[model samples]
Target chain A: MDKYLNSQIAKIDTSGIRKVFDLASKIKDPVNLSIGEPDFGFIPDVAKSLHEAIDSKCYKYTNTWGLSELRVAVAAKLKMTKKSDVLPEEVLITAGASGALDLLFRVITEPRDEIIIFDPYFMFYHELPRMLGANVIVLPTTKEFWPDIEALKKNINKKTKAVIINSPNNPTGAVYPERIIKDIIDVLDPYDTLLVSDEVYEDFIYDVGHVSPLCFYENTILVSSFSKNLALTGQRVGYAAGSRGVLMAMAKLQQYTYVCAPHLAQVAALQNLNLDISNYVSEYKERRDLIYDMLKDTFEIQKPEGAFYIYPKVGDGEKVALKSIEKDLIVVPGQVFSKSNEYLRISYAAPKDVLIKGANILKEVADELR
Target chain B: MDKYLNSQIAKIDTSGIRKVFDLASKIKDPVNLSIGEPDFGFIPDVAKSLHEAIDSKCYKYTNTWGLSELRVAVAAKLKMTKKSDVLPEEVLITAGASGALDLLFRVITEPRDEIIIFDPYFMFYHELPRMLGANVIVLPTTKEFWPDIEALKKNINKKTKAVIINSPNNPTGAVYPERIIKDIIDVLDPYDTLLVSDEVYEDFIYDVGHVSPLCFYENTILVSSFSKNLALTGQRVGYAAGSRGVLMAMAKLQQYTYVCAPHLAQVAALQNLNLDISNYVSEYKERRDLIYDMLKDTFEIQKPEGAFYIYPKVGDGEKVALKSIEKDLIVVPGQVFSKSNEYLRISYAAPKDVLIKGANILKEVADELR
Candidate 1:
């Protein structure tokens, strides 16, 4: 039976960072900072709308493409941000951002197709393409965690099918400036390479705000989800917007896979189509500032502009994370996101008091380890 | 971009059956019997549990394998009929049966791995395998739609990685009896082949009841969903139970794909852990009896044993269905399900009055055409 199984799945096992989380979950009270989701719940009004939808029999299957209203809502949101008239056909409602990535990779990449992935990338981007028989070519970043556009230019060959760019990146938490994004697009402009822009944390930016790659690249597929922004991770609702040709392929592939996201969740999402995140942004900024105030001098860390993560330089993330665990403070090692373990990712998406207490504990551990 | 697309996806267009459905929806007041979904909604207690779950703030990501309670409930249900000590580790909650199939096929099939699917099949069975670089060998059935197990034996070889067995089948409401199921298993037992038993319509049987392949086969993955029995198609929740080795591979692959099923839907399904399907079964029986009674004399048709569909041989199903459309009575052409257009699939899963009207119109068209 084991021999009959897909070998690629066996190739992907528990990451080192996952083991840290596993050890941390065993503790009764760990000041957890490895949370991927935001501390904020759905807007109060939105949750009520979900209840109303459930009572109104929103449980029946919508169209396989998804509820027409939600698709329209996704298009509207894109128009406001991406500054493009996105038609409903260009949008495919997915299980989440993860779901969008999965379907897009399946439809676009052929076997031995080279995909350019940045180092210090989101962990999911690693094995997915390789499993689909695509060859992964890692593009390492400089110390600043910005895209080395020259390195990208050197690697973009005819075999290169797609290049993934995750801004307000998971581990690094570095929101790319407009100039840097334009440089990356300029390097990709010559090639017909597909740009997969994952902006799941679009609403979570504290400074300078978010920008759409759709503004620069015609070949870009903007993948985003309501998981972090709307606190709907568990509901598994997301969407992908791109060129009509590419999206048509993704929608066709989705029919054979996830079918569609949950009907009731789609209906509820329609009620809160516009993101109202003033309070949420303010609260997270306070937490981010509090964390930086304590550990900023201890480690070579930058003040993050977006997402609920801060990746700081540490000698050995596994060792630091292990020491932090001993003090009941759960922090993830950077090896989860990249091949290197030189940095550790700390998530400060928690309450004010908890962050204050956790920061003190984290400072003590960092000082002791250093 | 079309040239750069995965050629398999381009080959598998939106289904012809789907086109028929699209056209049928425009008719203002057709006596519809072309539905694949059950007429009943979710169990009364389950919908309440879902609302309770939402109020309790259960809308966060569950473990990728799924909620422990739902897994336990699934294993418990299997223990009753399957007579095996099924464990939660062997069960993986999926997006739906379609999702389970997608995951399983991706993992098992290498390029050109041959899969066996019986003809007059559920339309979903056709394109998926072919898209995965697997050759779909359609096992042609007898005139009565019983599986040609002898024909299946001739085809099973080293390259045959899997074979799909669906009963109380779709389109044709022929329930495979225990003896027939046993014969199918006997052919499969020789090879290290996987048996994917789609018992989604298990609760819809009208005469000879459903049997589990898990009762006979060791290498079987029993794929069933709440879509039909519980009427939660829109929710898209289902489970796959099988050998731990295969399921572990599926669970791992799911992490990069769908992530997990919706959290609220999982909680809702827990309330109706045990099947209370007698009422649903009885009502479907009445509908089945009425349709069979009316059309038995009018056409060449078998007295269907299970499921909502009744396939009767007409001169040309396309002509009969088109003529029925003129009368505002909707019945699907059997060519949608099979290569030949000799039969039209009549769904009896409608209300009493609707089925009566649809059945009478069916008789009128059949008599005049004959």
Candidate 2:
């Protein structure tokens, strides 16, 4: 053996979330909050659409950018959100949000390019930038888990190629306020840095409106996927949208990588994007609300403005996770997200009954730990 | 906008095959043969397995490596070929052969690492190595489209990190004879260069026994996907088996890419692997024979020994491609594969009726040119 592992690949530690999940899976009746996946089955109509698409022989390689119709649908959705003027040409559908992120990393970051990310971030953001041989500079978020404008401004430097922001943030469901988003953009605008916004959880915000970097920055690259909103995690369809220059670059990179997302999944996503999902979104909102109430009353947790998660403060994050495992409850330790060891992110995207059962079990586990 | 695209992203050219297909798609009733996809549908049992798996909620993210069971199944299958002493731990199920190849390129090639690839190769093997910021040195194949050991030896340099060989070669369908494969391995043995064997069409050989480089070389990295042999192109499941070192490196790279293949597809592929597909293979062999007979007898073209493709000499490849398009017959110009403007690679993997219809149309087109 050459003993010559690529430095970039060697730098990405195996995901701690996966490590804990592996251990949790070995335990009987473990409640899995470590996984950020939405627990809802894919929307009935969406599932039907996939079944129909598969049977219709849409099971061939799609365009490297994605199915034209699906791209058009994504463009239309973006238009509705009043983001930048997006056409099908400006969208590159990917395997998932993770895949989109990977493409963005490959397109934007050369070795030694600096990427700024907020602390207590989606851990993958940190790992991905590093894997691309980019220097990841972490700016700590405010106490509210929102983007800290001053901290972000301080981190900007000439070598910074991009800033990654996950609004309706994972691990902590802190939806960055518009003012904060604008301020962050203002700082990035003068620096020639691309703002990479991960809005996979854009549809899951509770009280606050989801703000997209696409609205304020021409250089912004938006990454989102159907994994969360459509419960299509298994289908692995998502997209990256940006200025034509960035998207074109990413599209070329995608061609050499995986060619395109699965055609059947693209068709299903196209169908779902066009159809009315108001009922599902509303139901999800209800679940989020119900889970919020239960968690606030039973455990000391910070309520999130958007996304289906709560970052609950518990002493010794790993210890709390281990204690939860004893009760067959699965939750990710905050240490997985950052060096912080006092919080755990709990997902509320499961069905109401499962949430209720899980909440009760979590409450009992917390009490025993205290 | 920053004018600096990532060096890695800028190096990849858009897929030549996909570009040809895009142009071909515009023509009505075209007898398309440019795509490398299998012409057969999923085996009935595989389709049934997929349907059942999807309905049973197997549609979730598998482990980042893959579903453990699928890896085990793949390991057992590799044992039959006696190619490598591959264990489940040495397999990482991917979205497709393309996905596996992407992972390999990312993990094995650092900036400026030189990779050797045969000319008239699968365009991706050339494109992907370049995309990783690696130097690609093309060693032209022998006159018969087989590996030229002397040419490979001349190209091997200290900077060479890997050499790619695609047996049952694309565009040419010339399977490197066993002795040729061994000679190529012996050439690489002294350099500690990684041998990447892409055997996507492993089972499609007409008469010759498949010889894996892993059979003789410990450094060989074998890449195969279910798209061809199992007729599951859209499902996008594949596996890479190699020395534990190479597999580990690929696994790390995969972690930062798409994370893992879709869980449901893995389950479907697992079932498909165990199912008897002798009928499917037999049918493909029959189609290959039929196409070979038609081309050799009617068009006076040389017959290919393996893979469902035949590259016949044509006058001015691009002109012939355009002429075929005018006649509603789509065949890939050899220029797309290389500098050769004298041949067109036609796929014979279509349904018997379609292939017959296409062959007659092709003969008419060829006669017009004559």
Candidate 3:
């Protein structure tokens, strides 16, 4: 039976994240910090809208692209966030931001096509293109986890099909600055490469505002979801905005792929647009400060500006991560995100008490490693 | 922007069903028979379960394989239905049956690998494998829409990676006999080919009981969904049961592809296992008889024993389908499912009155063509 499996299957093994999760599940009330979703639940108003959709009998498949009203609402939101004239026809509601990336990669990637990603990137930025038989070129970022523009300029060529950028960055919560966004787009201007901007954490910034690559490039594929902002990760609703030709192609592929996103969740996402989530953002920002302050003295780590993670440069991430589990703490090793094995990714999306408990245990474990 | 797309995009075009839908949207209260979903809405009990899932704050991601309880319940159901000892770990919940097929093809298909399917098949049966760069060898079915055993034996070889079969099939409402199901599996016994059984319409049989290919073959990947019997098409929840090795590979692929089925839908599906939906089956059986009786006189068609569709041989189906629109009727041409253009697929999944009206207009259109 294993012989029937393709070569792509051999390239993709179970992620290290799942291994961490399986270990965490065994510990009794472990201070887990490996989750990628918000700790918050659904908003009351969004829940009401979902109930109304159910009551009104919206339980059949919608248009493959999505419900017209939801697409229109998403397009309007993208126009404001991306600072581009996005039309409703250019938007596609997907199962989640993961689904959007899956569709986009399916449309553009071929065997050996080069796709560039900065170090300390999200997991799929490497896995998706590689699974589709594309060559994923990992470039070094600055010590502070910012994109190395010079390396990007040298590596990008005609074979580069797309370059994926996630901000606020995963594993390390360093949000890209507006000037850097412009510089990255300018570098790609010489090629037909697409800028795939993953803004799932757009609403989680602390100090500065979020800058979208779409603001500088019309060929950008902007993907974000209501999973974090509205806390509907289980509902699996997200949107992607891009050029009409590419989006139409994704939609046609979706007709056979996902069919459509969950209609109940699509309705909830429409209502979520009118929500004010400033309170959640404020809460996450305070949690970020708490985790950074507690761990900065024991480890060499940069202060995160956005997202709910802090990457600390610990020696032997996999060894330290495993050692931390014995102390009832769960953290992801940097090897799961990149080639590096000297950093650990600690998610601060849990309650402040959990973060404090987990941070102290992680520090004690690091001291033992030294 | 179109230049950025790969060659696979050009191989796919907008399906003809969408064209019929776009045309129907312009007519006032058109007797639409082109829809592939049930006219029924979500079961009230299932809807209540979803609301409970929402109210109880179940909006985070589940395991990629699905919630353990749902998988257990599905395994038990598969044990009873497939007459095999299916373990809980072998069942994977997906976004829908479509997502199951997508994952299966991604894990098995490679460029130039041969996948065999009977003609007048489900659209995805042809499109999904082809998109994955497989050579789709479409065999011919008998005039009564049964599998031609000789053709199946002739076309299958070592290059044949999988053979797809859909019972109570779409476009043609033929429920395959039990002996045919065994014979199909026996034919593939000599080769290492997998039998991909799509039983999405398993419950709509009016005469003989449903037979699963998994009863005879361990390599059978049996795919079904709650979308039809429970009328939760928009919820996008389904399950596939097969060998542990194949299922584990699919689950790992799903970790990157879908993450998990909508968690809310997974919870509802767990509760839905207790639901008795025999009434819905009895109602559809009546509708199937009504439409077959009305159209058999004017069109060359077989009596549909199961499913909610009647495929009638109309002279130039594309022209007749278009002409029926003027008379406020909508049907799908057979070209979308096969190479032939002489048959139209009429879905009787609508209300009794709509089915009568649509059938009347369809008969008049066929008479005019004659």
Quick one: best DockQ, which candidate?
3
The CA-based lDDT of model 3 is what?
A: 0.88
Q: Write model 3 residue lDDT over A153-204, tens digit each, in one string.
A: 9999999999889999898999999888988998998786799999998899
Chain B, per-candidate TM-score: 0.95, 0.93, 0.97
RMSD of each: 2.0, 2.9, 1.3
Predicted structure 2: lDDT: 0.79
Error of 3 at B34 (Å): 1.0
| Model 3: share of real contacts kept | 0.75
What class would a CAPRI assessor give candidate 3's docking? medium
DockQ, 0 to 1 scale, candidate 1: 0.65
Q: In model 3 chain A, where is the ten-residue run with the lowest total lDDT? A: A13-22
Best prediction by lDDT: 3
Model 3 C-alpha lDDT per residue in residues B1-370, reported as the tens digit of each score: 4977888866665566667667778998788898899888878999899899889888899989999999999888888877878899989999999999989998999899999999799999988889888999999999879888899999999999999999988879988999889889889998968999999998888988889888689888988898888887898999889877888889988888788999888988899885888888888888888888898889899888788888998878889888998888888888888889989999988999999998889878877877
Native A-B interface contacts kept, per candidate: 0.66, 0.51, 0.75
Query: Model 3, DockQ value?
Result: 0.76
Taken over the whole model, the C-alpha lDDT of each candidate is 0.83, 0.79, 0.88
The predicted structure with the larger lDDT, 2 or 3, is 3
lDDT tens string, model 2, A1-370?
3364566677877666666767788887655555667665667887787667757766567778898888888988898885668778989999998899888887888789898888788877888888878899988888788878888878798999988899888878888888888898889888868888999988877687888878678888899998887777877789998778888887777776777887767887888875666676687679777877887865666678877778877777787787777778788888878867888878876677877877887777778877
Ranking by DockQ: 3, 1, 2
